[model samples]
Target: GDRVLATAILDRVLHHAITINIRGHSYRLKEKLKAGLVRLEETATTT
Candidate 1:
């Protein structure tokens, strides 16, 4: 439930950010968000 909820929230946030703009700052943020998401998924699967 937590994983699903977190992913849904992250998707919504990323979608909103993308709609605003897809420039340098957002690009960097998107990368960081993606990395964090990957780690989250890995941790969830491992545990």
Candidate 2:
């Protein structure tokens, strides 16, 4: 009953789930750099 319904919902969610692994610069920082709000040298030294 409840357990069966929960299992069905979880199964459907897992079926549509896709794992993502992201590795890159921050999009916000990139935008800032493009807008001249952030400096390339500052990011290089901070990280």
Residue pairs clashing, model 1: none
Q: Which portions of model 1 show Cα errors greater than 4 Å? A: 18-47
Candidate 2, poorest ten consecutive residues by summed lDDT: 16-25
- Our tally of clashes for model 2 stands at 0
The TM-score values for the models, in the order shown, are 0.34, 0.45
The positional error of residue 27 in candidate 2, measured at the CA in angstroms, is 0.3
Model 1, range 1-47, lDDT digits (tens) per residue? 99999999999888857455433434544575677744544444543
lDDT of 2 by residue, 1-47 (tens): 99999999989988979867777678998999999998998998775
Candidate 1 lDDT score relative to the true structure: 0.62
Q: Which regions of candidate 2 deviate over 4 angstroms? A: 1-21
